[model samples]
Target: MDIEDTPVLDNHMHLDPIEGQNIDAVEDFESVGGTHLLVLNKPSWHLFDPASDEATFEEVFELTIEAAADASEVLPGRAWPVLGVHPGLISQLVDEGYTAAQARDIMQAGLDVAAEYVADGPALAIKSGRPHYDVSEDVWEASNAVMRHAFDLASEVGCAVQLHTEGSEDLTEITEWAQDEGLPPEQVVKHYSGGRLAGPIKSVIAEKDELEIAAELDEPFLMETDFIDDPDRPGAVLGPKTVPRRVRWMLEEGWEDAVRRAHVETPARVYGIDTEATLGR
Candidate 1:
């Protein structure tokens, strides 16, 4: 298939209209042949106070939904919201004097609000995971508890989850957590993966080597830039145009089938959206 005919999607990304290059970044992606985005909510600290109540989460989710809506004006129906509590909030909560258990409760409450958004049709998926950095054991356990609650919420909403976590060779434990919660393992995506996960769907970053590794894997996987959309950190994880550019490279290198899976089929399956329709096929 021609590159123009393929639907290139960023499975996980963030857009901030207030402090970041919001819709302008979407235009950049479109200029480079990017077709879709899973616009995610930024962490609480990026938007407002970290230790605020559940109403604060409502505001964050609303901002994400609005961001996605604004992007849709550029990419039409291709941009979607993925809302949730950022796992790093656990550390911030603890530092602010809330106990680990209290932090877990707070995060779960945030997820509860996010789930309502998904169930009500504003968001396509939820974003949740344990802290990517090291922390005390109690905090770690609390983070896991929060993640499990995310899984349950996703199951209830019938949506996928994009996880942000530390690098690991094996993701079997997290996959089992999804299974125990009655959510399919494939619905739990390991965002920013290096393309070496044993279980859970891999949302591999669009670097060349990582994309190559993920292309060789038999299991279905997705691709992303994880673009933070921060002007100061310009292209921190990867640029908005990275996914489509790498997809063109994949096409030139004879990985058309992999491109189809990563850009079209996998996203259609994971997010339960019709990519062909989104691309106006």
Candidate 2:
């Protein structure tokens, strides 16, 4: 299929209406042939005080859902929300005077709120993971507990999860956790993946080299820009156009079939959403 005919889906992206580009970024993505976006909620601290309660989390999720809804006006049924407490927020909570255990409890409560959003409709997945940075053993353990709670909530809601955590060559432990929680490992996407990780489905960054490596794997994978949508950072993780540009590049480089799998088949199967329908194929 021609690049224009192909459906380009960004598996993980964030849009901020307040301090960021908002729908303008979505317009940018659409201009470059982006067909769909999984718009995950930004961290709690980005929208409210670190010490905010569950009510604040509900507001954050509502903003995310609204952002996705607004994006659908641009792309029409191709923008979906993914809501959850950011794992790094545990650090923020601890810094705000809550103990590690208390932080875990708060994070878990936030996930509960996010899960309700998924169960009710607006969101297609939950986002959760441990801190990517180093922390005390207590905090580390607490983060893992919060992540596990996310898995449980995802299972109950029958939705996928997008994880943000330290990069690793092996994700066997994470896969096992999902399976134990009764959520299929394939439903757990490792966002910002480097490529070819051993477990949960990898949402490889849209870099050409990473996409090449992930395409070589036998397992299905998805692509993302992890676009932060910050006007100040201006393409921090990558630009809104990154995925579509990389997909076109891949097509030029003789990766048509891989592009179909990564952008269309994998996302449809993993999220249990109808990519073909959304693309009006």
User: TM-score for all predictions?
Assistant: 0.97, 0.97
Cα error of candidate 1 at position 89, Å: 0.2
Stretches of candidate 1 off by over 4 Å are none
What 10-residue stretch in candidate 2 is worst by lDDT?
A: 44-53
Candidate 1, 1-281: lDDT as tens digits: 66788888888889988899899889999888888889999897887889358899998888889999888888833789999988999999989999999999999999999999999999999999998888999999999999999999999889999998889979899989999998999799999998778878899999999889888875688998889977789986798989989999999998988998887788877888877687752
C-alpha lDDT of all candidate models, in order: 0.88, 0.87
In Å, residue 153's CA in model 1 sits off its true spot by 1.0
Give the per-residue lDDT of model 2 (tens digit) for 1-281: 67777888988899998889999999999998888999998887776677357899988888888999899889833899999988999889888788999999988988998898889887899999998899999999999999999998999989888999999979889979988999998899899998779888899999888888877765689999889877779987998999989998888888788888887789888999876678753
Question: After best superposition, candidate 2 residue 105: deviation in angstroms?
Answer: 0.5
TM match of model 1 to true structure: 0.97
